[model samples]
Target chain A: MIGRDEVLHVARLARLALAEEEIEPMARELSAVLEHVERIGELDLDGVQPTSHVVASSSKVDVTRALRPDEPRPCLPREVALAQAPAVSDGGFLVPSPQA
Target chain B: MSAEVLALSAAQASAAIGAGELDAGELFSFYRERAEADREAGQEGLNCFTWVAREAPGKAGTRVRETVPHWPDTVRMHESAGSSLAGVPLAVKDLFCTEDAPSQSGSRMLEGYTPPYTASAVARLREAGAPLLAKTNQDEFAMGSSTENSAFGPTLNPWDRTRVPGGSSGGSAAAVAAGLAPWALGTDTGGSIRQPASLCGVVGLKPTYGSVSRYGMIAFASSLDQAGPLTRDVTDAALMLAHMIGRDACDATSLAHPQQIALPSAERLDGVRIGVPAELEPEGSSIEDGVRRCFHRALALAEELGAQVNTDISLPHAPYGLSAYYILAPAEASSNLARFDGVRYGLRAASSSKVEGATDLLDMYTRTRHDGFGREVKRRIMLGTYALSSGYYEAYYGRAQKVRTKIAEDFATAFASVDLIATPTSPGVAFALGEKTADPWSMYLSDYFTVPMSLAGIPAISIPCGLSDEHARAGANGAEANGSGLPVGLQLAGPAFSENKLLDAAHALERAIAFDSTAAHV
Candidate 1:
């Protein structure tokens, strides 16, 4: 079973804040899922390469498709882009200072 | 007239509009009115849509036409000149970003967030004259098997409100099934589109990975993510796909579609070699008897249609697909969802705790995510983080990728002698809401039959084959039981980029099955 400290550690790594009551249940559920997925370790996969993307291995696609020219095309205007930002400064995103 | 319009398939409706039998404006209004009625109907409604547009883009009274009249006219001319879905309004899963519409992706994290641009797939469909009618709800970040993970609320099944419309594309499937929208777009990572389509008794096609550009789709599992249509029939699915596919400059992974998506009309599956993998119904497995019966019956029907049925095919690694998928998908999800940090867009929450400096930023992120994400999303993020951590990376994530390759190779070996592989789209029909939510493993098992094809990145479709023998409880609130059983879906998967042939086979099976889509009423 995955322990509370382990779950808390994972939450910190994933940058999630768990509630006081959520930790135990999260650990239990995570342990259950991990146990199920651990069965994949039984496979004799020696020397087998991992497949990150299937299209790269697909035979139908051309390997040497031409890349788009580095021409500046119409894009979302800066103001429009900044419109969705939670906190905006003068023409850019505003954030807390990095230093103490 | 309203009933007749609602009854028409998307293809038939498009043709009617072209022949002047249906007015595009009036047709759009008709669907909009029904969708609004359904949305407002309280418990009787299938809360499918997250946002419904008042008017289609480029139509009169909208800003698009007000600024550019000739542009709307040009679009109209193109529509009349025979775009596949001529002016048929479309319902999109909220994951596809639409400019100026709240594409929240069914999460509080993005509540009230509108994108500045439209998805490549949505834009292409719109260019083909299928205007945006509404944005449908989905599981938050398209993570959950059932739509219960939607932070807004679960989208109830149109067939039986007591049951879940399988998700994360449940709202798209429910919308199409209930006639809330003529057709809809849904993304399938691990059976999101097909499972929901199966549960709702509609047709869903998950095209080969990268066949349809994923430019504006909210990322879930990038390598496995694919966008496809959830329609009422195979022909309508074919029509929607024809316009949605092509290589796009914006998405490097996308490739040019090899063949045109023809509206399949073949009534026989002659010269087709179908393989039924032994892993589909292993001893003591969760495959429900009703679903298994329907699957075997569909195979029998395929044989009657002159197809060679080979039952000896074995995908030994397929049983491990669900395990590998859970690892790979969430690992990718953890990386993809890192952009949701409380900085640029979406929801931002201040930390409740007093912290100094960089810790303040960290606290803000944790608090925002904790407050923003639903339980399932949080669970996945945690699981993914654990799997990809320094020590566990090779044991979990790396091994899962190798298993994924093995599953793909299994399919390749099976496909060497078979034209198509068939399985039940899901273990069973639409399950009751909250039935599996308490057990995440059970929920994960819901994709048992559908995940292998997804792992292979092959084209697969779910078409309604028959209804289950087990009837919905009498007088399930919001929908009349009518003594009819829930819908069961038969999945047909083919090798990479075999959408045309797969559709042809599904179309043939669809006709032979003769499943009544309108049997269940909301």
Candidate 2:
């Protein structure tokens, strides 16, 4: 079973601050799903190549074909890009200092 | 007039507009009013839409010139002028970015976030003269099997108010089923579109991965996430898919769909080889009795329609699909969702005493995500992070990918003899809201029959097979009479890029089954 410390460790790795009340339940739920997922370990799949993506043989264009000329095209204007940011500085997104 | 308009399929409505029998504006308004009424019905409402566009009377077929920049210049003007859907407004899943609407993706993190440009798929559809009707709700980050994960609140099923509309595309399925919109767009990671479509008794298609461009689609699991259609019928699904597919410069994984999504006209599945995978419904499996009964009945109907039904098929690795998917999807999700930090667009947690030692950038990110994400999203993020972290990567994520390879090989082997494979879209019909919410594994199992296709990146379409027997009996007895029973979906999955063949088979089965879509309860 995945314990509370492990859950908290994963949460920290994921950059999610778990509330004091949510930790225990999160641990329980994680353990439950992990139990189900751990069944994959039962399969003896040695020398089988991993498939990260499935590109159909019948597809006319593969990943390489999706590329156009690497020329600059019209993009979201600076104002439009910054408009949705919760905190914006002069022309960029504002974030807390790393060492603050 | 309103009833007649609502009853018309999206393709029929589009044709009517072209023939001058129906005004585009009138059709749009009709659906908008129904949707609004349904939304306002309180306890009786479906609560499908996250944001409904304001009434745009005569602006139905009027092209939004601003979106033209997003469209590829080559073939844009011609396709826009002469497309199948001539100004039939579309209901979009909130996951797809639309410049005109808030694309929150059903998460508090992006509560009011709107993109500067529309998604390639939505923009293409809009260019085909299908106006944006509304942005439908979904599970937060398209995580949950049921729409209960939506921070906006769960979208109730149109057929039975107490039951869920299977999700993360629940709102799209519910909207189409309830006659709120003629059609809608949905994304499938692991049966987000098909499962919901099955539950709501609508038609959904998850096109081959990369068939429809994923540009501007909020990433869930990049390899698995595919945008597709949820419509009332196979013809409408084809119409939507025709306009939504093609190669896009913005998404590297996007590809040119090999076949034109022709409006399927096949009424008989003559000589079509269909395989019923033994892995789907082995004894002691979770397949519900009612769902299994409907599935067998659909197979029998397929035989009657002259299809060669081959029951001896084994996708041995398919049962492990759910396990692999949980690992792969969340692992990808962990990486994809890292962009949701407080620095950029979206909710930024206020630096307050609530955030313990909230001085640094790390504290801000942690606090923001904690406050922003729902329980399911956080759970997935944590799971993904754990799997991909040191010491666990090889055991969890690496092995999962190899298992995925095996599942894909299984499909390849099965497809060698059979043209298409069939399964029940889900284990059962929509369950009651909160029924499986307490058990995440049970909720994940809701996608049991549908995940393998997603894993193999093949095309699968879910069409209404019939209703669950229990619900049918209840309706018959007038205990909870609604003329319609809970929907059961029959899934037809074909080899990669076999959409044409898959749609044809589904269209044939759909015609033979003739499942009534009218939800009287809504």
Candidate 3:
């Protein structure tokens, strides 16, 4: 079960600000989701290795694809890369200062 | 007039264009008119597209020629190669980035943000000469099942305007259904494409995971996401899948080897063994009477056509798919969505006027995401952050992964005895517009039947089997009570790389049922 405090904590972790009225409702919704998902814990998965990716690899060695060769390739031009930036400054993306 | 060509399956349209029976220009006009009509029709118009291209390719000064510089090499390769998908117009779900059109992913956060490239799947479609006609709407970041989570507003069901078309690929499904375009691209992460395609009475194929490259397609759940086609029938889906699938270095998770799927040569499923999971029966789960009736009738039809239908198969862990999907998808979503910080692409909350309200940089990040994301998006993000948070990881995400493994093993075990599995794509027909919006759990449960295949990373197809009248009468509200003649989808799933086999079974079922998919109004 989740509460308003947990909701706020999670929001902080996700870097999402919640309005005052949204906190309780968000908590309620999250609690419902948790309750629904909690059913997974009832079944014992003693030796099951979790599947991170569903790549169709029949053998352990073939599961992971070889990484692409590290030859340097052409990257997106600066103007194109910055096209969608909300704030740009001196050909670089701008954000609020890291230091508070 | 446009209805004739619009009604043609993508394969038919392509062949017509290839044979010179249908000119690309006229086909484009038909699709353009239909797109404009749908856009103008407002609420009843299906409202399927987020952005409709003004002119089709081959026209002087068209968007394709104007935007070729931003397109990847594959798309540019076909620009000089003349018409190839033989000029069949393609509508794309907004989740796939098209350099010419704004790829908003049905969220206000990325409004008007045009990516510098096109999705690899879409590039292949272009390479095959499928003209881009429009960009369809979807759930915000492919989150909701009803498409109601769209900031642009929900797409009305073409079948019955009052009912939903299903989501987050609702627009793509509805567009194809209403004859706006011959076929469209849709991504499935926990049944986005299949469920909506089922509800809208079209053929939707969710290819085995990693079969199609996801490059330039906005990420929702990294591991679960796979792009496929929403078409009028099985053959068209096969054609689109054949063109769209290939290995791409841009997406590391893309398949190492290209998959080649072609139209099935056999007309009947003589030796196919179709497994009907016992847990999915109406007596056990919440499947509606109407859907159950249609499913049984389709199974009977399949049996008559030489396929063996086995109803005793038990997938004990299949029912846990929804829970596991919710946990795993959100955990990945929380991680995938972290790139949307205010500094880079997408909307930012920080502004000169809002500076007074924010305390610092942290405040900006918080406010930006909070203000940008919709209610459902925030809810999932919060849930995912909680699950992946330190100390809670093993309890939620880790356990969900194990359940995913169990579900995959269940399918593997079942497939050893049977060639394919059968179920109703959704439990019921589409509900009215606002019916289940308040209850996210109810909406999530709509995908219960289709989520298991997604977890198992298998191929599945949803095809129109029959019409259901139950939701029209004694269902939720009178809005759906008029026997809206809603279409019911029969889902057929197979093991990984079994697209040809799955499509063969689906084509057999399709020919047997002979369900008319034409919307009354369209």
Instruction: TM-score chain B for all models.
Output: 0.94, 0.95, 0.93
Ranking under DockQ, best-scoring first? 2, 3, 1
lDDT of 2 by residue, B453-518 (tens): 999899999999998866542332225655645789999999888888888888999989998877
Query: Compared with the true structure, what per-residue lDDT tens digits does model 3 show for residues B340-425?
Result: 76777888874521333435678778878887899999999998999999999999989999998888888888988999999999
- TM-score for the A-chain in each candidate structure: 0.82, 0.83, 0.87
Q: Ten-residue segment with the worst summed lDDT in candidate 1 chain B?
A: B65-74
Q: DockQ, in order, for the candidates? A: 0.58, 0.62, 0.61
Q: Write the per-residue lDDT of candidate 2 for residues A12-67, one digit (tens) a residue.
A: 89999988999999888888889999999889999988885676432334564455
| DockQ computed for model 1 against the true two-chain complex using alpha carbons | 0.58
Best-matching candidate per TM-score: 2
Worst 10 residues of 2 chain B by lDDT: B73-82
lDDT score for residue B405 of model 3? 89
- Model 2 TM-score is 0.95
TM-score of each: 0.94, 0.95, 0.94
Can you write out model 1's per-residue Cα lDDT over B1-522, one digit (the tens) per residue? 888998888998999998999988998998888787776764467889888887645552232311111211222211222255678999999999888788998999999998877777887788777888988989999998889999878998877788889999999999998888999999999999999999999999999987788888999999999999999999899899888887776777887767767778789999999998888753235788889889899999999999999989999999889899999999999999999987889987755323334456777788889988889889888889999999999999999988988888888899999999999999988998899999998888889888889998999999999988875543456445666678899999999889989999999999999987766544
**Model 1, position B369: C-alpha lDDT score:** 92
Candidate 1 residue runs with Cα over 4 Å from true position: A64-74, B42-44, B56-82, B282-284, B350-359, B473-480
